[model samples]
Target: MSTLSLAGGPVSWGVDFADATGNPPYTEVLDGVASSGLRWVELGPVGYLPRDPGEARAALAARDLAAVGTFVFDDFHRPDAAGRVLDAVDAALDAIVETGGALLVLIDRPGEERAGTAGRATLAPRLPDADWARMIDLLRRSADRATARGVRPVVHPHAGGFIEFEDEVERLLAATERDELGLCLDTGHALYAGGDPAELVRRYGRRVEHLHLKDVAATVRTRELGFWEAIAAGIFCPVGDGLLDLDALRTALDETGYDGFATVEQDRRPGSAGDPAHDLRRSVTRLRAAGLG
Candidate 1:
């Protein structure tokens, strides 16, 4: 009955594609994670794995990895932008079904441009009441579509993105009916935004569809790091080494019976400035000790 699945987002691995974009083949890393005791992985974008679902499924099966979910990003809240967003969601849903993954995560567009100071000071506050309402409407429609396909739609609140704080997250959750939208809580981002991960889980456990298990090493942030830098650094540590309270989080998840993907998401790849594999092992060990695995 333990709801834990050994899943991760390999995009965190920091692989350089050279010219190839999307998901870099993590067969080696997938082997590492599975050996480290993970059971599944939430694959990155489409090409990050094999473009063909059969190939992707075979690759996962070969590595003993279950495809728990995948992510998509488009402006679903804008009426004029509906076509692309809808198409993207449909495509994502098809992939999930094809690969036998159960969840679909929706991330907010990072902003028109990745302007750090200007974004935080200006663009963040400009979202009018109407825009938020529109977002909710889009969420409802998307949720309906996902439900018809039997794939859960999880709204991911991001840090460094426009709706990146506690208030914004709360507003987003409040705006939608619980059945139509669930939270894809990213622990590192929650900590960066000063929200208690355990508290959010406890308050909204019923609406949790998936989780991004990560830690943030605040000391490395250098104080001068911008939003992306913080996002790049502040949110992708191995499990126990950062500021995230995983033990508390586990207790909350256990009590709530959240049987979904608790995916470790470290956007930075291994052998970067730090040892990603070591950090990941430490995280898995910690989660095991806490009875969360």
Candidate 2:
């Protein structure tokens, strides 16, 4: 069997309530993940589960499930005097340490402007030079803290966000110490940002610590939709259902000996997981057919 651990996350079942001030509940999403035949799942959008480590652990235990990772979206470019964003990362790491998760996914919080008026990705805002340094320093600090806490920190280059473009990703990789920081290679986002997934993995596989195996539908790209609009328009499709040559990507991973959790994240808007459990099963079956699962 391959060393890669195949899994799925909340967004697959439309469970990401990241924009809401508070998460409504988690039973449906957790159960959905467990029942979808994925032995592992990620703790999506912090605060979706109980903040108390003990409760979170028990919740997963009850489901006979293991956590592969937890997503932490922080705006390093925007921070308050309260140090809340850093504190939130600490909280996420604390949960990961206690809940058997090893990867802490770091994403930039660029939703507000990126999803403005049209609710589409504009890619308008660029961080100032000082802010770029600020973001890198924060990532370094966060990585060091996570290292002390026993989890690896992986940056995700999200669409319509600060690090969406390939050049920006290159800059981030250049600025951060490779040993301390790695990337969550979200395949769909890479394609949406106009980068080839197989090529990217071939070049940067060493810096990859975690994976979100999402396929993309580039039809939305021609529409020039916003980030949220594209997601709502099915920018993320199932494995083997879009533009990605998943088999080729898997072959590349094999050559690189990159064994890690490959969580299928077919991102959808909240409450938009129409027949998603079936879609997830089919997706997994597709990956298995391609020697992925």
Highest TM-score against the true fold, candidate? 2
Give me the displacement of residue 199 in model 2, in angstroms: 0.3
Superposed by TM-score, candidate 2 places the C-alpha of residue 189 at a distance from the truth, in angstroms, of 0.4
Model 1 pairs in collision? 6-39, 12-266, 12-267, 12-268, 13-269, 14-269, 23-48
The C-alpha stretches of model 2 lying farther than 4 A from their native spots are 18-24, 79-82, 113-124
Among all windows of ten consecutive residues in candidate 2, which has the lowest summed lDDT? 114-123
How many clashes (backbone atoms < 3 Å, residues ≥3 apart in a chain or on different chains) does model 1 have?
Answer: 7
Instruction: Give one digit per residue, the lDDT tens place, for model 2 in 1-293.
Output: 23678887777766555555333358777787777778898988777788788888888889888998787776766644127778878878877887888999888755575543221223466678987888788877888889898898999988766777777888999888788999889888888777888788878868987888888875765677777777778878877778889778878788777878889878777756356667777788888778876
lDDT of each: 0.71, 0.77
Looking at model 2, residue 38 earns an lDDT score of 83
Q: Each candidate's TM vs. the true structure?
A: 0.86, 0.90
Candidate 1 lDDT, 166-272, residue by residue in tens: 77777888778888888898887777666789888888868887888877776853354555555555445777777877678878887888886787767563345
Model 1, CA-based lDDT: 0.71
